[model samples]
Target: MESNGTGGEANAPENLLGTSPGASSLRSRTESECSDKLARFVLPSMDGSPPKVLTLNEVGDVLKNIQNMELVHEIAINPEFKFEPYEPPENSLERRIKDIMHKAFWDVLRGQLNENPPCYDHAIQLLAEIKDCFPQIISQNNTRALQHINEILDIDVIKQQAEEGVLDFRAYANFVIHLMAKSCAPARDELVRQLTEIEDVVDTFKNILETMALMKLDMVNYLLDFARNDIMANSVEYEKKKFKEYLEYYKFGFPATENWLKNSCIHDANNKPCSPEQTISNAYMELMDWDESKEFPEVLSIDKERILKLGQRAKRLCTCAAVISICSGVPVISQRTENRVALAKQIDIILQGTTNEKELLDSIENVWLQVKTVINEYLQKEDQPVIDANTEDMLKSQIMQTGNKDSPVRTLMWKRFQTYFRLAMRSRAGLPPPPPGYADFKDELEAYCTALKRVIAYNHSVFGEYFMKVLTQQRVTSTDTTTSAAAAAASATESVEPVSSSAAAVTEEKSVNSQ
Candidate 1:
């Protein structure tokens, strides 16, 4: 392959000397230029004195070492080796083998980079090429892998840093090595299986693996150090990059209809002057003023953007209701005009202080508890005869209980109420009513809400599961340490007892003889 002009093989002595007769002068010129370039590639020593310039011989040796390393890497991931079928080792053996293989891989990588720093670019390129050998290594799709790579090695950032002469090639190389290991896991596993099967080479493989694992860890530390320094040095710039990426996924500004609530209050159905508060208050009242002849308003909407906004509002309302009910020890009356007014006021207050998505979601969870309370109350009343208004109020006052906040029933009720509240509010006076084919739109909206809830719930559950796993691991580790310590103490006591008994026996014998 032709040199990439970054001083790979182009400056090799053999390449420089092996020129045509007519190009003897050109060869000498090239040699002189290469020597000058090699001199400029001065690496600083640990003692931080004068930088050490590479001699032609040292450069040749470095290039040779890099070539040999690349050759070994290629051989390790050879198609023939990867395709060789072999029985996997037993579970215990497999774990050991895996650990060893990882160590070996990383050790070689670290040494290769440290010895020949200029080979960093080639090493990274080789890793990218090797990734293609094991297509099934990463669980995520290729697109996602590309996106992850792009994020870590943003080309713009690289260019900017390079121009500024502050680019850390070693850190970048470590990151690439880490990625290569990850991408080559399947291939490595296969190779490990084959190696472990061979008794003669097992020890060598284990040694290699151990080295690689240690090197991989070092690489991780190095990358982390780089990130720490970079963040500390350019905090604002780092944050700007992060924020720019986040904005690409989620829009920053509120929707166009963000003022829907305010607008609802300003105009009546006829576009006449009206009290926005009163209009909103009456809309809540109309939720319970259901007529037997009039069909229920479509509970779904097709306009996803609009529905999303409505969902946000509904979530806010639910949260406000929950907080109020929890704090005041009052059963949230969804239909009462006064309650709706109170909810709106609470929502306003909540919104005023809310600064992030997390806060908003937390608020919604609070309201979800109240919804659960109401649902449970209704379920309990299912078998009982219809109580009079006064009797119902008495029952509510006496028996209303705040159940487990994380109850599944609460989540279900919360979801149902989310849809109901969104539909009801959207149909409010002065607001745009559900468009034509409202029924289908309502179905679509409900589906959208259900899917959204599922995604949120799934994410929450994943985090919860991870947290539990970490706690369990910590507990297990603590228990193991305690048990080991106890066992050691007991063993020590047993050993000391024997010695004590022997000493006592000797003393008794001596005493008897003396007597």
Candidate 2:
């Protein structure tokens, strides 16, 4: 048997063979149908070009678009979709949170100011105020520099430039600074030289002031001693009158004689002396000539009052010095007396108005510490005796009046002294000595610290603790009820609830039912 031209097998004759050809052709047709079905679903490009295989990114984009379309369809169909207005909390918690934030911001600003003080705004304001004062400090030749400063300070021009965002004042500020520095160069150099020349100017000044105070005391004492001696010697009226006159003149000046005669003598209603007895009395009194009687004469009256006044003044000054010494951590009493004498001389020079700024600057170097130490030591040694004597007189008077041995007055005085002494000692203890040959206007530092303490009575540690407590208190109070409720719920769930098998089974059943 022979095959046909189209490769189709011919049917077998009645007497011929066994296999069918259609089975092979059926398998090939099934494969072709599957390929055609797949080709029918292939997508074409937007430009009507042949279909191209999509990349992974393009497929992801198509999936995202389909998800967006489904979301839009769901929103359109849903009837419960409603936009709600957002409501702000109406409670103290919001206010408290704001306050805490405000406090924190101010604290940070304060710290910044402390770290780098004299900020640009303050510096500019200061410059404006002291513009006129600069002329006196600087030389006439610096007029051009002054003009430049004035030009730079023009508010209108500055504002215009600032609006245009081209304002740059740094160069102008630097120029002014350099000019002023140059102008003050001579004064600054002079001060520096004096500081270098003087070994310890502050110590010298303190010593001088202390010695002058002591000398004043000694002079008064000598006057008293002379008066006592004259009275004991039974000096002649002429000599006594002369001594009395000197005391009166010293205490009250020349007007004392006229005033005393007019007041003490017998006078007419017109206040004029009329009798010879009045004249004699006036003459003798004016001369301060008087015999000491059992009552003790009034010849030394003015001197006594003057002494008391001087003593009180000295005591007050000593007290102030002692306080400053304790605060400054410097010993007032130096080992050497020569330093005290030098200090006294320097003070005299200053009082005479002959001392220039350079000399004054030199004396001011570490002055607070030096003055404190010197005054403290002087009070301890010299002024203490006077204070004790005064205190004794007061005690005597109180005793005579109340007849009480244990008075509250005495206790109060004792307590004050104890406190003062304790503070003084504490200030001195463990303080390092100032560096050798180092000098500056330490009084400025003392003044600054005093001002700071006046404003803020509490120390840094106390202030910090208080500030933190305030912030924490606010934070605690500001915590919302919702947060508290949530915390409470969590605690309750943890304490009493356990994940038992029965509970788990119940939860699963509910989920299955919901599904």
Candidate 3:
């Protein structure tokens, strides 16, 4: 074949730019640029090629790495044979298949969790993705899977995970639901039931999942959702550039998979299959179904903005609540008390370098160490006379008056205080507020406030009677300045013009005579 100048063939300089038309130099430069691009674009596929062909022994080693997922096994055993032969199943067969798949999936997850609770995070994630893609398969696969799914539902494992005060299952489940809606449809009943269960759990983890998901989703959608419905829209505005580029890619028909995993910060390029890192990333990516690219957009600019907002809000609320808790006569320690102040200072020391994202997420426990010191300080005052008196009175008058020892208000008060105190310390740096109506986050605020109040109350009950005595004495010495002002006003009125009332007096006398 005759060689074209496309490959690295030496061109005759006389026939190239040297002897061509006026724009020949430009054309030559363009060709050179094109060649450079081709060199970068079409290298040997060392990095991108498929796995090398395995020898018989190597294949056995590979098979050993395969996870024996029960759900996968159950699906493989489907008698409907539609997946293999592409036959349409009858309604009964479809239903049976889905039922079996769902049960098997949950059973596998439960087995995984029981085998190792640490793996529950990975197991929940896989189950959710499987449910999302093959909802139909899950629906009609097998009845056995439903029983296991019900067992998870029965033990309220997901809820327990949340109640245990973590986000492992809840986050996994949420991401799954998100993937399902954006990628495929989940079974209507199953989705609804799981969502309802989620609603009953802690909102903090829910907020975390949703907030993190929105961050992964991008800020433009978040802003657009907010603009369209200001009342219900709740997302931070970090990563707008990244999000905007992502939107552009979407418009250009790019898939959403790789970007989602990339934004989540969980993707691992080195592992595959059963490794949670790979499984989680692949599951979400499969839902999104997009190819990876190096020239993708950067929608990550809003991270600091949202984190700042959340951090500042948390801090201000804690300050206000700390003050109010101290003033409410609820028997709490003063936040500024020497020991408490010292602890706050320690928090300030940590806060000097920490990020709002860290504080809002409460991933840093050192913040809580200072808070615990304050709590311990308050607890030590329980034996003091004033505290003893108040406790005794509270037990006798209020506690005895109620049929139940724990009233909702009191229970919530204590719980709310604990939450608030924890939050105050955990997020001393602050977090951005969620979208509106999300104001119910005040429940969390209330909880945080209550903890501070408890600390204050404990201290005040010990030392508050003396403080109240000092205040009463000060009040006794203070003059009734308002009453004095009123008397002076009356005297001034008497000294002013007397003739103004003459017409009024005549009218009054005439009225009396007529009566």
Candidate of highest TM-score: 2
CA deviation > 4 Å runs, candidate 3: 1-330, 334-352, 356-515
> How many residue pairs clash in each candidate at the backbone level?
13, 7, 54
TM-score of model 2 (CA atoms): 0.19
Residue 348 of model 1 has an lDDT of 43
- Tell me, by lDDT, which candidate is best: 1
RMSD of 2: 46.2
The true-versus-predicted C-alpha distance at residue 480 of model 2, in Å, is 98
Please give the lDDT score at residue 143 for candidate 3: 65
RMSD, every candidate, angstroms: 33.2, 46.2, 32.3
User: Could you tell me how far off, in angstroms, the CA of residue 127 lies in candidate 1 after the best superposition?
Assistant: 44
Arranged by lDDT with the best first, the candidates are 1, 3, 2
lDDT of 3 by residue, 68-162 (tens): 12112222222221222223366778777876876676566556555533445544454453443333323335567545445544334664664
lDDT agreement with native, every candidate: 0.42, 0.36, 0.37
lDDT of 1: 0.42
TM-score on alpha carbons, each prediction: 0.17, 0.19, 0.17
